[model samples]
Target chain A: MAEPCTRWDAEGRLATERGETLDAHFAACPDCLAARAADAALSARLVETGARWQPPGDWEARVFARIAREAPARRFSWWYALFPALAAAGLAVFFFAPRGGGGPGSPDPSGAGFEVQIGVVDGAQVVRSENPKPGDTLRLTARVPTRDPARVAIRIYRDDRTLIFACGGGEVPCSLADDAVRAEVLMTAPGAYRSIILTGAGPLPAPAGTLDADAAAARAAGASVTLGEAVRVW
Target chain B: MTPTEDNPTTPPRASSDPGAAEQAVLALLERDDRRGALTALMRLYGDAIYRHCYGTLLDADLAADVHQTVFVEAWRDLPRFSGRSSFKTWLFAIARHRCLDALKIGRRRRSRFTTDDDAPEPADPARDAETDLAARSMLPPLENCLGGLRAESRTAVLLRFQESMSYEDMGKLTGELAGSLQARVARAMPVLRKCLEAAGVSL
Candidate 1:
């Protein structure tokens, strides 16, 4: 008498990894044959179902229009005059400012003043301002002071406010005590990119959607810094 | 009815020489003729990409958004494409990620609302019926059955059967072990069969 086939045997049969034992079992076993037939029928149905879908005729045009509207900006060589002042202020805050006791309404208890600098990593040096090509890698470095180990979140967005990348949204939010935090972002296209840094006594909200909304949410949460920079690729 | 059923004049498969077409697009992109390259790329893979997106996302609007994002990201990242993988694979990877992101957003919204009543409604049935009538399609039952599936299972089934992908290719695209993917597909089949049966599908 042939032994009854197990589900694994049926799986083997489905995978076409049939052995003599399974072949003999299926030859004698009505149940196994039925199961195999059911599986095949299901697979066929799924394939047929998948084939039935057809995107609209103008789907390509719609896609093209969307990309046209949302695509990253092309390389722009004109440096924004405001960035130099902002960079200078950031440097001054990082270097000369005194650490006061945690201020009223400040999220950080250690009175850690936050500063973020966006730059392109040149060979062995971080350049504060440079026209990065499309494929260049940019570095975001932040100095955050914390009392206890705290959470830090960073979100980068394109000019259109679409999310580029986000960290600190999941189980392992970025942790920092009192040091500089750095993340590398690959430049995908030439665009005005914004980086928002959030550090708080608790988990920070993950940024989604446009830049204005993200900034507003981060500000509402009480501890965040937003920085914007432009890149050109040609 | 599928496109093959209704359309007597489907465009001949874009070209016999996909490699040549890909190369020409890449050349245009490299030369900064982004608009021209994009148009060419669209003509080459637009329908297939849209279908993949629609299958994965299960919503035409979301799929369209993901479709756009894939190309926008592709344009940005084209320079970084090492050509280690085929262009189709790379484009599909982007589409998958964008779809996943959209799913995450949808999940977040659903979770935040906290009530079943607050969940998004299905597409307007009247509009869908009109579209279906015009297209002479009968996929709504299948769509309903697919909607009943766990997202992972649905994705596995779509990638395997609809995309006609090998287990190895599916594993690469999904970042799962091939054996695990095989198991997932195996588990998904029975559930899908049951769902379809319950939905009164002949299968």
Candidate 2:
């Protein structure tokens, strides 16, 4: 018995491989050929007489403008609003609460001096410094929170320069002092320097998370306005 | 993320109507005034919407009302866009949904008696003078037969043949699986063929 003359028969296994055997079959079949021809004739006639349709003018700018207005506020606020509302609120309420024998007017120890926490995540240095600059020789001081010795790294960058260098991390395990971990480094010039204390807090922990609005703002807190500062700085 | 990412170019497209003016109107619409969206919609799709209504409902004036209603509904709902789909696709979905609703109501009102396939003779002299007048007239009857089909099959024919959408894009707009869409088209072909043949149109 003879097999049906299908597109697969004409084109070999390529049609089958691509999963286009149906299209191939329709293309090759005389029945489908006549049907398509009739369909084409009917369509052309209707189109010639039918009203034309097009997207409204200014559709692009309109759609984009709409997206632009919504995208910013929605994306940034997830962390921005959440952090200040929750973390900052908790901190505020804690600081405001009565402590020891003193009332609300009493001076707070945490408020008197700078508080810094440093850690290493996946071999990158993450530091919360009160007043750090590029040229300052930071002493390595750790109290107890430091863990994963090799995961800690200190990256220093000069102001107005793209050169980033690894000042510390490999052989020297960071030393703990009271509440801060210190690493000594010489900056080429005094400028704004960023120290990140990466903590593995997310589902997919990496060196650090993307700089969301809250994290960026937190990095700015208590950072020195001066290009360079003396010893005992956070 | 990008225009090309959403609207992949597969084939040459028909010259899009001047989109700048419609955009201007939309800007006004987005400004909390719907007059501009309405005016722009009428200018851009008034005729097309009317045709769509007529095609779907087979009534001229109701089609006109549907045309107006589409824009009004669009104006009311424009603020809800979330960018998950293109504005064009969203708008068409609305229009398609409305057409289907109107069709359901139309079916309830329509008698169950089926219409015969007898060809209506043209009374106009110019049409009579044409060498292929009968053939030309047969095309409209075939299209009218297409109109009698379920909404999806009718729309599939119009978008594929008239709008020149590829099956992939058609699937996206209609929310049909690509495999199923191909099968739908194949199934629809015989009905359309029979319609055209009954209308005395030669393939």
Candidate 3:
């Protein structure tokens, strides 16, 4: 006597056919038909019962409110830092522009002499904060004066002296023209990240070890302005 | 696991347009309206997520906790949602992972506290008819059978039937091959059928 096909075997075959009916097999095999019927009944019952499960009374309100409260704090911290710079720029324009007749070469009234802004690009938008989660990509934009042959490098370091990323070694420095210099850093680990941006007279040396060590090395390279910002990753 | 009694809230509003709902969610999230997007998402998939968590964990409180965690994580990661997968699949994947994590924590707690007296207890037959009726009304007898299967098997069954997910979608969401998921569902069906038959369920 030949062995009958098990339910698993029959179902596997049916699944491969993408819902094509196995009428001929079902017609010949009572056991398979019964099994199919049982499976259908079970599926129907599950869907029916599951459809009846309800969320809490204020589930939408609670979730929306909780996320609203928790999400913005982490997202807006970088923006809060940017706000001061923006306000100072506005103040400089308000306080000094009239005195200088709004001329193009009015001593660069913002007074910082250079502009460096760092954010993370998520989807279509460039977000201010590096979402403490691993795998976030950070975007850095800097505007340097045309006269200075400033070379740019970004170094990201974890709290324990482990180097996360370094760019603009001797071979490939992130050279800044009069326009904005843009670079991206992909965050790989979750911890405290200290990202140092170095604008040097020549090619910035690659970062080594901790932020302090990197800072010391850049200082040795002579006539470099280094800016450090702390990023916390969850 | 002790099953918690169901406390039904208002029934979900039926929407004829899932695409519109998805668009509305993405639009809000894209505009940085996290609250609005989450509110739309909750309206659309909250009950389904709760059911998935409850079915997998078999504990209402834990399910609710995982449900909240899912939304919170979704809101946090909403910016990175690149639309490679549908929002529904993405949300369910998150729900599945949170439930698995909760189950791991539960197992750890159970293992640490296990004693001779902590052996599995038989079902109580002395319960009143009203309680039984309530349980039956809330969940079919087949759910009790589902509770007997391993977590992976039960999840596969639920995702196949309750969620109406294709093997391909389930494979993508779970990072398993489609054939493997099909085999899992195939293996799970017999156990479910046998349990249902033993429970005197008609086919």
- Model 3, first chain, TM-score of 0.45
Interface RMSD per candidate: 9.1, 23.2, 15.5
Residues B1-203 of candidate 2 have per-residue lDDT tens digits of: 43223433221122275345445545655675444454445455555555665565555556555555565556545554444544445455556656755653443223122231111112222433342333334435655666656668777766665656567766765657665665565556557666767877676
lDDT of 2 by residue, A1-234 (tens): 665443322343223323553555566777545545665665676576455433344443444444456555543321112122222223211111111333333334344232232222122443323223334444333222223333333333332122233322233334333344345454434332334332211211222222222122222331111111111111
lDDT of 1: 0.58
lDDT by residue for model 3 (A1-234), tens: 777667534563446336655556666676666666667777788888787766677665566567668765764545323223433443211111112132444333344444556676787687646244567776655443332223545566765277766654433334332344445677786455566655555656665576655665665575243334455443
After best superposition, candidate 2 residue A100: deviation in angstroms?
57
DockQ of each: 0.22, 0.06, 0.18
* After superposition, candidate 3 runs with Cα above 4 Å error: A1-23, A68-234, B1-14, B115-140
- Show pairs that collide, candidate 1: A75-A232, B1-B137
Measured with C-alpha atoms, the lDDT of residue A78 in candidate 2 is: 14
DockQ-based ranking: 1, 3, 2
lDDT of each: 0.58, 0.43, 0.61
Docking class of 1: incorrect
Displacement of residue B92 (Cα, Å) in model 3 is 1.1
Q: TM-scores across all candidates?
A: 0.60, 0.41, 0.55
Scored by TM-score, the top model is: 1
